[model samples]
Target: MGKRFVLEEYLAHSTSNVMNGITIQQRCNDKGNEAIMTYVDHVIQGFRKDGFLYILLTVAPWCRFFPSVRNVYKNIQEGIAKGNALFDSLIDQREKELDTNRPNGFIDSFLVEHKKNSPSFEKKEQLRIFLKDLLAAGTETSSSTLRWILVYLIKEPKVQQKVHDEIDRVIGREGLARLDADVPYVRAVIQEAYRVQTLGPLGVPRQTTTDTTLFGYHIPKKHTNFKQLMACAQRSKTLAQPRKV
Candidate 1:
């Protein structure tokens, strides 16, 4: 009967639950905020649709050559386009309200620097892509990593017990885990889960200038998402979907 709470709203309105001392509730227009909240669902659906597309591309690169794949890819591209339009709208609104004297959040901060014509900020498209990545990767990647951690913990009771003991020692029964918290064994358990089951199998693409090798891995001049190999070496890893980067 009531309205659903969305991630955008939570980030905008929350006072303490977020990080880096940013909130957009005060900065954004009420009408724009309402529109953004209503649109968040569609944006999330687009993001999930993109995830499916990524899986398809990764698993069956050959399918892309088929005629039917064109329609399927176009349909998915439409969904992604919707997400892009939503961010573009949000960016437009933020640009209208952005104040350099005191920036609102990440976008505003970036805009301030962008006004100075920073090379990285020269491309607004990059910022849009970053937002897409932030929303998509930030949510599913983290939750998937946590899910894998639980799977491994349940499979390995000793590791679970060590994590539990470490939690008790460091955070205690009542304390919530904070970013600033120090808990090595628990962190190691999470890290080990990452190693055994990599999250970002296809990491962000980066091209090398010259052929280079690091940490027993060889790098060619072409682009590489080394997690393709890490997925092979997964002794521990995190923050990536089972999907290739």
Candidate 2:
């Protein structure tokens, strides 16, 4: 929960910087965290539910014919649609005030680049994909990683105590921003956790460029080995298994 809060604030600030400079965190605080989280949770839910269907669609485009899968896709699209109004308004605001002299965030940056006459750039579609990736993929990955960290800490109290003691000694009353080269253990713990329980068990899927043979098995062009990657990760001896909370 705490991690989720921090992630939301980080995402909101990062996104808001580009959109207009109106910090969404401040806006959420004025309104209420509950409202913001509710919307985010719903959107993340749509992302989680649609994950399998999305993979299926990539591997077998015909799966879209299935009513259940189609419904899930529709719902996911609908969830993204809910945020379209707000995002579009922000984009519009940025469009009206495109100050290349002082670009605020990514939206402004994109606007500046769009003016560069880049033939390959499709401004609107790129912006939509970028926003969707940030809100949906970023939130889920960050929240899950933090949650996994806590799980590890809870299961291993000695490590947790060491971290606490280190923090108390190194940071004292100072905030995390005070952390510097002196914080090796803190970084180590985070790195180890990332190695063991990465939220993305499988790395990003990639399509084959051409026909290939691996271990006597034929792989056609455009075939994705994302599932194979996930399986290998799961079987990795170095990856730690989670203990009961």
How high is each candidate's TM-score?
Answer: 0.65, 0.70
Superposed Cα deviation of residue 88, candidate 2 (Å): 3.3
The per-candidate count of clashes, in order, stands at: 12, 1
Write one digit per residue (lDDT tens) for candidate 1, span 127-238. Answer: 7777666554454555456656766777778878888888898989998988779987777676667766665666655567888888998877764443475656542355
Candidate 2: regions farther than 4 A off? 1-39, 47-61, 83-86, 117-119, 178-182, 209-219, 227-245
Name the best candidate (by TM-score): 2
Model 2, 24-76: lDDT tens digits are 21333334334434555676565466666765776677877788787876765
